[model samples]
Target: MSSSMASSLPPLPRRVGWVGTGVMGLSMATHLLSAGHSLTVFNRTASKAAPLLDKGAKLADSPRAVAEQSEVVFVIVGYPSDVRRVALDPDHGVLPGLRPGSILVDMSTSDPSLAEEIAIAAASVSCQAVDAPVSGGDRGAREGKLSIFAGGDRSTVELLSPLFEKLGVLNYMGGPGSGQRAKLGNQIAIASTMVGLVEGMVFAHRSGLDVTRWIKAIASGAAGSKSLELYGERILRRDMAAGFFVHHFVKDLGICLRECQAMGLALPGLALAQQLYLSLIAHGEGNLGTQALILAIERLNNTRLGDGGESSG
Candidate 1:
């Protein structure tokens, strides 16, 4: 809603529980703790949560433990299945430990239907659930500049604005699962943009143009995009580290395709991007960044970027 409206809402509880401390999660949770909240965190690999722990966050043994000690618990894991397990697992899920009136916020890029299920489950326990999937990759997360799309009761989502403002801009999309649908739309746009970006780079490389200069020239023009700004240099340097994992992107696109099918929509661009990304997973590059789509494109064209050599694949 409006900035004035969010400013008028009550502050979020000082006690926060965070599950999933991988790449982006670590930075996101750190912001809450930095805002002077008392944080309890849990991750499958405790070592991954070490940074947060070192920064004064408590390490909970399980998702349930985290929820018990928290008033506002957040889950931002890898897959929809993981979200189901961490938030709904009857024995150790967050729901079981949640007290009435506690808030459960899931920031994972998961199925919208699953978000609906979580909201219903939380209601049964007299707790509130909000789906708030985020955009902006690792750098944005680290800089606290993410765009958060929140879905839940309008009042509840607004109540969380103070906490969300700590992380980024918050847009309350609608009822439960709407945030996820928004995120899926985001993924669809990103998929097409990424394909276009990589293909342009490949075309530049093959034409004996200075690929680096080409990026600079077009980056500020109509051809420019956030995807280009974020991943262009990474692609140029061949740095494929997981800013956003290739495998996770494939999962997001899979969800988008399924949603599209259910809506009777055809998105050939998204379909093409999915197949290209799937090829990366097949070639054991699933752990790389989305910029690694360049690799798949290079393989298809038999031309490597920058080196003037044919792709080994």
Candidate 2:
């Protein structure tokens, strides 16, 4: 959207409930506070919820409290299971306390079907729910440059536009559950791109080229992407720290693969990439970055990246 067009956006809703305060959530909640919105936040772990509190973000005792306290409740929990629990689990769930006319925005990447189910459940309580899963990483969250794919009513989406802008670029995919579907697409692209990166790096190293420089030179070209550029250095330096965990990527890919199966489609690259990620978990590199796939590539090529020894691939 154009700058002038965005400047005319309706004011953001004043009260926001933010659940899930991990790597991406903290920065996102901080942005809303900076934008002058009142935020009530909750995390299963109190400490993960602390930094926001320090920044003057209010802390809710539970998800129910968050739901009760805000006009909009934003959830960015960890996995599909957690998403279900946060939305539907009785007692601790946000559903019981959420008032009518409130909106619940799920920013977590999870099953689209489940997200739609959440929408239905929220509606029974006279509330609206949308799946607005996000892209961009910890860095993107911190920089307020993430890409959000939202699925909801057009008017309601417009109602939340300012909040979305405060978070990142926005794309309105469709109604109810399209955002999660699009996010599954995002994971497919990311997983396939990483696999291609692994292949290219392995080929370059086997051809006796300076792998690091080659990746740097080629990544800016049409063949490269966020994954390649972001992960290239990690692959070269063999940094395995979790920017996003390998296990999560595997889970994302698993969602995509399931969707593909249900759609009667076939994606060999996605299958291979999924297998590679599962292999990494089996090798006990589940907590490493998605770039840890390079370890798998090196193993297939019978090579190593300096002294990061041990089969924690």
Candidate No. with top lDDT: 1
Tell me the deviation in Å of residue 46 in model 2. 1.1
lDDT of 1 by residue, 1-313 (tens): 2234333433668889999999999999999999999999999999999999899999999999999998889999999999999999999999999877788999999999999999999988877889999999998899999999999878788778888998899998999999999999999999999999999999888887888888899998999999999999888888899889999999999999999999999999999999999999999999999999999998999888763322222
lDDT of 2 by residue, 1-313 (tens): 1223322433567889999998789899999989988899999998988888888888888898898888888999889999998888889778877876778899999999998899889877877788999988877899999999999666677778889999999999998889999998988888888888888877777666677667778877898789876777777777778778889888888889889999999999899999999999999999888889988887887886543222222
| Pairs with backbone N, CA or C atoms under 3 Å apart (clashes), candidate 1 | none
Screening candidate 2 with a backbone cut-off below 3 angstroms (N, C-alpha, C), the clashing residue pairs are none
- Superposed Cα deviation of residue 91, candidate 1 (Å): 0.9
Error of 2 at 7 (Å): 19
Mark the regions of model 1 whose C-alpha exceeds 4 Å error after superposition: 1-10, 307-313
Q: Pick the candidate with the highest TM-score.
A: 1
Candidate 1, residue 22: how far the Cα is off, in Å: 0.3
